[model samples]
Target: MKIIGNLFSKVLILIIVLFTLMPDASLVMAEETNLALKKEVFVSRETSGKEHQKTTDGLMDIKTSSKSWNAKSSDSITINLGAILDFNQIVVYEYSFQRANGYKLEISNDNISYTAVKEDSGIIASTERNFRTNAPHYVGVINIEKQSAQYIRLTVTEVLENKVSYIEEIEVYNSSDPDKFATEDTSLNASTDLVVDSAFGFKAPKVSKTIEENYAAGKPVFVSRETSGKYHERITDGIKNISTGGHAWNIKAGDYAIIDLGNAKEIDCVIVYEYSHLRAKDYVLELSNDMSSWTTVSRVTDYVSLNGETGEKSNAPHYYGKIEFDKTSARYVKLTINETAENKVAYFEEIEIYNKANKMPEFNAQPKEEEIKLSAPVVSESIPYSKEKFHIYLFIGQSNMNGRDNIPNSERVILKDVFLLNKEGKWEYAQPYPFGTKYSDYQGYNRYSSVDEGTKNGLNSASSFARAVTDNIPDDIGIGIISNARGGTSIEKWQKGSGEGLYEEAVRRTKEAISMGGTLKGILWLQGESCAKKEGYLDKLNQMVTDMRNDIGGIDDVPFIASEIIQSRPEGNVTIRKISEKIKASDYVSSVGTNTIDGLHYDAESQQLIGVRFAEKILNKIYGVTVTSDALLASLYNKEIQTEEIVPDYQFKIKINGKYLITDVEPIMHENRLFVPLRAIFEALNSTVEWEESTKKVTGIKGPKTVVMHIGSQNAYVNGVAVQIDVSPMLVNNRTLVPIRFISESLGAKVEWNQEIKTAYIELN
Candidate 1:
């Protein structure tokens, strides 16, 4: 009996000692419950520099120097007074540089020992200069993770060639563990507690709570709890240590404490903890950047009670709780404790603070100027067109097709029916020709015609010809004339794919037309001068025709017609013969010879005759009209032997010094070039024509007014003032072709170019 009593006394003593060292069981339970609470820390950099070190006052400062240090150097430098800090991340901010080169980062635990963390050989640490006031600076971010060091050093490997390297700032942060942190809570805490009932009717009473221990200085605050009373609340009013002004009651299973933050920088987040009890609803969290502006972060209403009796109870107690802010800028933070059930009370334990983080600057580059010019216009809707029978004609090839004649008069023709179909399937009608003439004939539309003043007449002539031919043809005939003709331009230009050359433009226009729902039929080619001047005339012509045919989708053995070039004079027959021979020899093309009084252009009669001839030969073939023989052409060329008396269709009567003079007969459209019979007109105006063949131009001097005309260019000079002519001047068959009617009438002379006899007559008015 004595031994058993001694053993029992020893056991009792041991139990007392264990009880003393174990601390209060309730306090241990409170700590265990709060351990599941989560925390976060956010750090932001706001300045530029290389070295960012914490000062004795705990404020961070960035520093930089001019000395270039090798970042890849094995030599080490120690940082003084370092601590063992658990840093999950480090971000280095750098400015713009031509290339990324020369930068190193090192960390050290002891002042005597160091470890190289990051050694980048091609890290350029420089801020780009902004010449334009609106140009933005470039920035780079260097992330250092899984690195254990208290002190960090950045060393430059190589200095930039022309620019200086700059670092804006560096940031360090400790990552938070989410599993260890609670995202929801059920206990009644002041910061996150929300009331739903009035069972424990607490009237407009402001309650407060304090968390006195185990608080990190710069960690995010989390909260979780529930409430029921009508008027219960708490706030964290600029007090980081403790809260006052609330009754300290025996907190039961669901009671809560409240904290109030006074006027300060905005509160980004708040935290709360429930010691042991469980509740059903979630917590309500609110924040304020300014005390006046309040934003509710979250509401906690759905929670599972971990400590319920059967693990299926509706409101069991829990320990861990957390609430996070959506990275806002704020100052004052507050919490409210709602009343619980009659016997239930809320519990509270911990609070934390998170500093506001900085944001990175955005960079967006601008687009180039040339690209802006090439952007196609937007089309709202497509025009309705038959997809089955839309035929596109691609008119490609040399100068004649390019239309290098004179500009037609404005009264010449109103091309109402002619239209160029745009990519959006919309039609754009051709404008009236801007010159002074009486031949206002309707013509088919021509696209991509030369705009140079000299080419207007030829283009107008072509238009008239096309209109006459297609008038009764298929309405589905969509003509896309990609006339990329340049005078004195060679086949090489089209072959070279140079700037604005006919080949590229032709291809582009053809593609555009086709994309707009037009099917390419054939290419109307009329170029050979360049090839004729050189040797490979046949080969070049063949290649050009073949390429065009292939590009236009190889439609029905694409037929090409070679227009026989007229002579500079009626006697220069060498070119005509060459053209005829080449056309007759080629299997894919037909030849149409035009009559020319001059070596350059065809007269109106010749133009009509040639058009008819071409229409008969090529159009007939296209229309299934087979020619039995080539005898008719031979007969027409050989049988023209009679000379008829030239009668003036219209006579110009003018008063020259009040004297009526019927001047000598003048040829209207002479040498394939239109001549104004300037001598008669000038004589009528008391002036004379001065010829300068060396300049390929003519000058008419009449009473201190000098009107100059060039053979191939659009602009003319009248008395030293530049005048824009509708049509370019031309020299045909040793005759200086001038705009007779316009010049004569404007210079006080009445003149006319007769259509019947094809002669020009002028008189001074």
Candidate 2:
């Protein structure tokens, strides 16, 4: 009985030990509930397709026999997870190269019915290449409320530019799983559709929004773009930790993320937490009563290294900074990013405005030296408001001068030495669409504003021209541009002191640009298209130049370079070129052919090239620098044409001022050289043509200049002076054909080509 009792005791102890060592049954079931979104388990199906079908059925392996769900005819795709699982997030991998514009996610326990979870619109395709994915890959994560779903559906509602759409892979994440997809309450201020750059994935800050709110109890502020997520809120939400992501604003220079106080409020101090990884440098803190006008309170230009200043890293990736001011008040605050510290991206974590509704000190009252020292932890010296010794150039003209080309990616970058007197009457990094459209009739002067007050805008050549000039000149020389061109304005409107018109506004802007000791170097004029067919336009142009030179400090002999206007029809081109010839003949006014595509306006590429020509003219005529060979004068705008044997394709479309020519004899391409019937094109251009049979030579006369070209020879004579041509004159189909450039240019006329349309334009001076 004792031995049996001892055995029972041992068994009882063993049972107790087993119970103590066993895992929690509830936890084991929860672990099984938290199963990862397995790719193999996802029985994927897609919208039907004629090609690349069954491709979206499995994993995103491109090497296998893959198929794609095309969005050619249909614009929706539905995926079934095949089993009920608790999930909240769906991740999709785009086709190897194609992308969808907009899509929405829906979930349902029953496949017949689904609930909408998340939707995004205007999502741009990924430009950065990921070799691991074998193409430009972008991942879209759709978040939903925690729920059990047997099926999930993805519907693409919009496509960009009708581009081919497909999905390489899809993933479902359980929202309840903390390790994979934790639900965070964050409200995004910037469009979430534009925020897919986090390929490495993002970890929402572990700290609660309440922590930041407690820190900003009294000072009130609102941001233009806010972070929208469960873990985040608008700028006023008092987000302090880097664990919570920041508010991403527009990345362009001079674009600001504004803070509205609701009304004019006095504020003396502000604390800012820049993005943990990316942040702005050389920014501005400005105050304003009306959003239209702003006063710069501080300019922060201290160079913060890529990871931020050493020892100042409170949040590892985030940099903490403070901006303190002499006590003042206003309703609106603006943080204008002049530049990014490292990347061309901008974002901020939190901002605290202190001394709410503090009354402003008396105006023009100088503070005691001791008062300035105690305002902030880091006191900054005020940046001087003057840009001394900068070289300023005035840009004025009609539509093409105002700009017609859309800004290309290559030209959108910022340059340090090149600056523009922005529409706001402030110097900022030069950019496209620099002209101010709206003029307040409040005063006789141009009190400009950078705000887009319903302005019609496009990219112009002035910025590029300034950039080129900046590239060629000494580094010490700052290049400034005053863009005053108004689209579709006539010469009469550009006359100096034309009483509250574009010209008067232009003069005001020019004076404002040179107010701080910058030298007015020259004027870049591209006009005459509006009055291309008007009589006595040359006289009007000459008078306008004379008036402008006098108004801008009576500087005689300032170089006024003009462009041979482009026109849709040949006759209009002839009429404008005649006037352009007179301007070119003037001592101060020079002319170069403005390259065009549609026969009306200079395309972006041509505008870039023409801007280079403008720079070349500036170098030669003003600075006396040699851009090409010594023989090619800097004043010569066609210096590039003289070097290259064959010009770019866009240089082939020709226009005479306001008209495009249609002739019975088409221009011929021989041995990579362009040849046209000498008589047909010239006669259409209003020039008298004669053929000398004895020498197989043709002589064309327009006004004072005569052009002579002989058959089968590249030698041509302009007013008795011999010049070399690209191609020799030839006879074909009983018509005499000559190298049009040589013949046309020799007669003091301008010739241009439109590469986009494959045509030529000729203008007789």
Candidate 3:
């Protein structure tokens, strides 16, 4: 009995220790439930081949994860956890690298309101990598802190063109568990008929009464020419992520895609997202009912012609094209790739077709070309408004300009005489909504009272900007906010011309707004988040500024405030601010957002602040106002960010054999050669310089020798002898810069460079 008692005592103590360290058995049983297993999941949009399948399979291993779910671009998936639960974390599971570019995880209970939990690129982290069991290596697992929700949503921001965004499985837990997912709630489980895909599976969402449908989604695609790859039908595969097995079809120059809608349907719009970086061809879209005769539906039709003269290198931004016209009936739509760019291919990813009557609720791209034309009448005879005193401000950019942050009723303001351009091409009283749709899409919808607008119906910087502009001025001096911005759109999408693209649309609207007897006070811009990491952003931005100034009158006369973006990515803000320095008439404002809710967008307060800044900057820069109506506003806006004065960036102090020489254009070093203004150094040596614009030749004449160099040529002629220069002569602010050492030495001056103090000494003895 004593021996038995000893063993029992030890076992009982062990049990006590286990119970103390581990969670209470009854508590775990009551709290730990896999809320998503067999629960009803809803997807925003479901295509044919890449459909939403049974993701609640209660498995996270690699093999079973093949039964994945899919969501289209800018589409979302929502899962109902049956009832509200105080869950602390969400553990989403997916395969490796087989995903889109970005996605957002959100938590909500009522289904109408949502809070973005995590909005990161769906890439796995080093700590989350688990090659043995799950894929994603761990992009799907998002943690929610001090939060409770019964419903969760995941939205795919940008997919690989037409590729479907996929995920293996999603599991919600009460704790941040690594592996142990407790048994699901039996009461919430239901018999599902959705088929489990053999490989990354998908089941189409059942047709709903109100779901915005994609007509050409998952339809049969027949290419005019196909390469060796198996992606011949990828156009209709509804796959937006990378097709690693094969690239999208861009094999041959004349390759085209023919999408069969399965039945004759009326369509007006066709949008295509191409994969290749080079595609500067005039694409033709034709529709047919009998496959014999075709009717041309225009747009991006004259690509090369629309964008001035070709030979300028094309890029990926030009490929995301859309064509909209009068509604037409057709069963087959064909897209032909133009064959202009040699060595560069036109790889296509996704194509969507839509009718005017069945336009997606969220599709407020650009109003029809005819609608933009209708603005003339409104400008002529619409309502009672002043043309001279009414100041027109064009607001253009990406979502930040379009408004992504929610605004409370307290923040909502509708000023008298302040107007917003409506879809009807008429100026209407500014609405209380924070977010602005395309000028043509605004139906005066107000969401401030409903409250908790989330990302939808939020306040835009333009509205706040307008209110700020109108507050101090006389009642007669009103402002019009022309909202023309699209979310997730690259700056390339706003390229000049491109056949009724956003750029041309903005130009037309600006002209129309001016026709309303309003002076072009200024243009407010906030973009660059899309291609912040893309190369040649400066060149593209300069081209946009040049093109806009060329198209709009007085655009160069006013302050083109290029605003910075959120702190999440500092590259865009850094790059965009350079425009103010590069362009004389332009200026920049600091980002008007802080404490970002999702690390991507601003909240209501930030948007209001943005408006205040725009008003302050425009008043300070354009109107040359030293004092604002409010003393605080003047102080806030007058805070200088970057000085416009010409300052030495490299801290260079030029010395001609020890005498400091001040230059109008700062001397910069390139290719190990210190470049100085051709006239600055040449004249310092008493040498006269002559420039030939036609030949791009810089000729410097000294007492004994003469040297010649082209604007962008490294090869030069010194005393009639050929010489290879290390750095080419370049033009800056209309002042030509040439290699100082090469030019000074060629002109009989000894040149010495100081590495310590960055002083260049030119000796002329």
Worst 10 residues of 2 by lDDT: 439-448
Residues 1-765, model 1: lDDT tens digits = 999998888778666655654645444433222110111111123121112221111211222111111122222222332356655443333322223355676676653475777776765423322211111122233445666665655555554442334343344444343123121221122223334335323322333321121112212222334234211221211111111112112234333333333334433444443323322234455566554667777665543222222111111221333355676544545444443322344333334444333111122312212211112222224324453454454554554554433333321443333444433344444333332122222222232343222322344234443444454356654333233344556666556344545665566667776776656644555555435535666556666555665665645464555554442121112233344355432222222333322234443434444433444444455555443213323333332422222212222323344233344554354334344555665665777778776887778887756788778877888667676766776655655556555465435444444443243444442
lDDT, candidate 1, residue 706? 78
Which scores better on lDDT, 1 or 3?
3
lDDT of 2: 0.54
Better of 2 and 3 by lDDT: 3
Best prediction by lDDT = 3
For model 2, residues 425-498, the per-residue Cα lDDT tens digits are 66765543323443111110011222122233455666557766776777777777776665567778766666
Can you write out model 3's per-residue Cα lDDT over 79-132, one digit (the tens) per residue? Answer: 888788777656655443345567788889899999887787644221233232
| All candidates in order of lDDT, best leading | 3, 2, 1
Which parts of model 1 are misplaced by more than 4 Å? 1-388, 406-411, 414-418, 421-426, 430-432, 435-447, 450-461, 474-482, 496-500, 530-533, 568-599, 603-610, 625-765
